[model samples]
Target: MYIHFIAIGGSAMHNLALALHNKDYKITGSDDAVYEPSRTRLLQKGLLPKEMGWFPEKITANLDAVILGMHAREDNPELQKATELNIPVYSYPEFLYEQSKEKTRVVIGGSHGKTTITSMVLHVLKYHQKEVDYMVGAQLEGFDTMVHLTKENDFIVLEGDEYLSSPIDRRPKFHLYKPNIALLSGIAWDHINVFPTYENYVDQFRIFIDSIVKGGILVYNEEDLQLKKLVSETTNTIRKHPYQTPEFRVEDEKTLLQTPEGDMPVSVFGSHNLQNLAGAKWICQHMGIDEEDFYEAISSFKGASKRLERIAETSKAIVFKDFAHSPSKVMATTKAVKHQYPKKQIVACLELHTYSSLNAEFLREYQGALNAADTAVVYFSPEAIQNKKLAPVAEEQIFNAFDRKDLQVYTNPEDFQKLLEQQHYEDVVLLLMSSGTYGGLDFNKIAEWIK
Candidate 1:
């Protein structure tokens, strides 16, 4: 089969392009700009476009399909070419669904923990010598690519994101998967720009549950009241299995799981992660992995790329970088770190980077979200707001949104870094949270400075 990918430089898009290429299909892709990892990997595989930018000429009638990425605008020249040629065009999720329609699709969906839970399932499956076609959000340790497809695998695991499928497709990506086995980690209102109301944001998950194939199973975090209520209201003929944070304890900065085998030590910690572990376990159980085998394998699962990833550690303190920007996520991460190290002074720094986070109205949701931290710091670049064409967020709004009298807000990255560097590092844990880099702040240098 021959296929072409438009806006293929995206993390998921590039990985999908490589997956099809590995499957021996003729694949070509075009993107206006390609960054590291995607650029290097595409170059290595000879899939890198000879020239950057949309080339309408590259879209040919002979191609089997054109996969569109969310990065591409509706007026993208290559997309227009595909339409003009009357060639089939599929959004990334739509194509993923087509490829795995025959397999037992296992989709992990939620406002958070989708990547971590999906990675856990993949890790355990690999440990048990089970081969499965999979697409996870983050780059995992043992996996060569984020997307993998095979003809032999009977199961396909997908990290189901609720974001729009593509510029042309407004449906949530997870809604297209229609999983036979589904897992919803939890529901926390996000994407304020799209779904302005909390109820609207929540209705998406309800629709996702209804999308499960008939007689399919849904494994959800029962601890989440919103998720629990959604599951209760659903009338679909699907099996529902509820999970909570499994028995676990933290000691000397280490988290140990109370498994059937015995107390199993884990590299990852916090209530949120433990809760994710329970959801993963249920999903794995549905996939034919025994409880004993799952626990044995999961003991070695460190974490996903940036989900509470340890950037650096020293005798005095440890610095962690996490992809947490939403109010609920920021709260959970902050509380987790404080819970794990009760004695350490926790300095929680979050960057208001996304459209939702930068919106002044949405900032109210973050009230008391970072209360767990001994020191709370929030940063948002006015330049970023301008770049996104958003209304500027003021320092007073930030302070009131957090409802913390001592909250320190910064609009400048240099000032933020200077303030951080001047703080006493001894007996303190630094938690850096953001979906974007702190305006190009070097994490490694900050880690060293903290040490």
Candidate 2:
């Protein structure tokens, strides 16, 4: 197979490129600017472009397919050249569907917890030596690439995102998968730039549920009233199974899960994580993993990267970095951390990154999200806002939005750094939540301080 990628340096696109390259497909890709990890990985794979810009001359009639990434615009030069040559173009998700159409597609979708749920399922399956093709949003410990593809695997597990597939393709990426087995963790309105309204953002999940194949299986989080209501009311003729957070308790700072055999100690904790584990167990069962095997494997599951990941820990203090930017997610993470360490007074810091979190209108949704923490701080880069071409968010707007008078807000990285350096770390847990690094804060320095 001969494939060309436009905007190939994206996190997802680069992973897919490496997967296809490993499959012995002739792959070529172009990206104007590629960051670390993606740049290093692609270069190591010999798939990195020699020069960084789109070259229409690279597109040829011999190419079998052109995979378009979300980073590429409709007017991208290489995209135009491919279109002019009448080459078949496929959005990233569209191409994934084309490749896995013959296999039983298992898609995990929702606004929050999808990545962790997908990682948990993969971890259990791998523990049982069950090798199946998979694509997850975050990097798992055992997986080399975020995406894995094979011709022999009968099933393909995918982290189904509700985000747009490509600049030119307005549909949600998950809609293209048309899964035979699907899981919806929960829904929280996001991507305000595109969806514009909460109602419109929710309709995407409704459409996702409708996209499941006839007689397929649908697993949902029953505890999420919004998701439960949708699942109970859906007319789709698919088998349904609902799951909630299982019985668990924290003892001596260890998360223990109650099983038929006995109490099972797990590496990961938090109510939200426990809920994610429950959802993963249901999906694994559908994929032929028994409950006993699921619990056994899940006992060692650390967690997906940046999903409440412990960066540094000591007898006195611990630090967690989480990829939480949405209002619901922020609240869930803050509450979870507090629940796990009830005796300690924790300091929580959130970085308002992502387009949705920066939107002036969307700020109100985050009201009281960080209330669970003993000390809550919010930071956002004005430069980032300007780079996104968004309206400048005022300090007054931020205060009114969070409704927390004591909320310490910083508008630049220097102030955030000073805040981190000046903090005393004894007897307190630090929770840092953001989709992007807090303006390139040296995490190692924070780890040293916490230690």
Candidate 3:
């Protein structure tokens, strides 16, 4: 089938384009701008648009469908033309659903841990020689692409995001899947710009739960009180399976799982990940994987990229980078590093990068989020705040928000780097938490300098 992608340079959109290309479907895509990795990958596949930006002339009726990305605005010329020509336009999630309608869809959703849980399930399934169409948000160790779709797979694993589907489609992406099986890792208020209130944000998850097929299964994280309450209150006919953090011990900086066979060593650590593992186990079991096989395969899983990933290590120092920006995620990631290396000094540095993180009102929600770190530093750029059209966030506001008298704050990237360079590296765990680069700092160079 022939498909044209509108604003296809998006991380998820590019992956889907590559997946369709690999599936022998005729794929063409156009974007106003394409950045690294997406640009390189698209060029490699010869799927890169000959010219950038949308063109109304490209929206021909002969195209089977036009896949829309969130990057495209509502008034995009191509999208307008597609509508004028009466050609079908599908949001990326909608297109994915169309492709997997015949397959058993397993969707993992939450405010966080969705990517990790989905990656774990995919890793275990791949290890067992199971064939499945899948889409994960992050780049995993062995996966060629973040998305893989095929005609022969009987099942599909989707990393369900709770964010809006597209500019034209106001529904959450997860709600479009209508999964046969679903998992909720946990919930924390996010996307404050979109949802505005905690209750409004939670209503999205409720809608997602309601979208599950009749008699389908929902595996959830019982440790999350809010999520637990939601699942308990749901009267849907779907089966409910709840899980918590599994029994595990940290030994010599490594986390080991207590199993009947023996103590198995796992590459990923922390209570959040352990909780994610338990949820993945339930999904895998429902997919026909035995408990023993799940345990064995998970023991070898090295974690999804940038979710508590160890970027550099030495005899006396270890540096970790994570995509943690929300208050709950910041707290969990900080606690995880501290718990694993109790004897070492913890220096947790976080960048206020997201729209939610930069908001003064939202700042109050981060109270005590970084308490676990021995030394905590928060950094934000005034330039970024202005660029996003957000109110200026004072360093004093951040200092008070964390409720840690000792918290250090920086509005200048240079000062942040200098402070980082001056820190003592002896027996220390350096945790860098952000959804963005801390103002374009080269992590590898910094790691080498620290070493």
Tell me each candidate's TM-score: 0.98, 0.99, 0.98
Q: With candidate 2 superimposed using the best TM-score fit, by how many Å does residue 100's alpha carbon deviate from the native?
A: 0.5
- Reference-based lDDT, each prediction: 0.93, 0.93, 0.93
| N/CA/C clash count, model 3 | 0
| Alpha-carbon RMSD, each predicted model | 1.0, 0.9, 1.1
Candidate 2 lDDT by residue in tens digits, 276-376 = 99999999999999999999899989999998999998888999999999999999999988988999888999999999999998999999999999999
Residue 335 displacement (Å), model 2: 0.8
Candidate 1, residues 35-75, lDDT tens digits: the string is 99899999999999999988888988899999999999999
TM-score of 2: 0.99
Lowest lDDT sum, 10 consecutive residues, model 2, at: 442-451
**How far out, in Å, is residue 219 in model 3?**
0.6
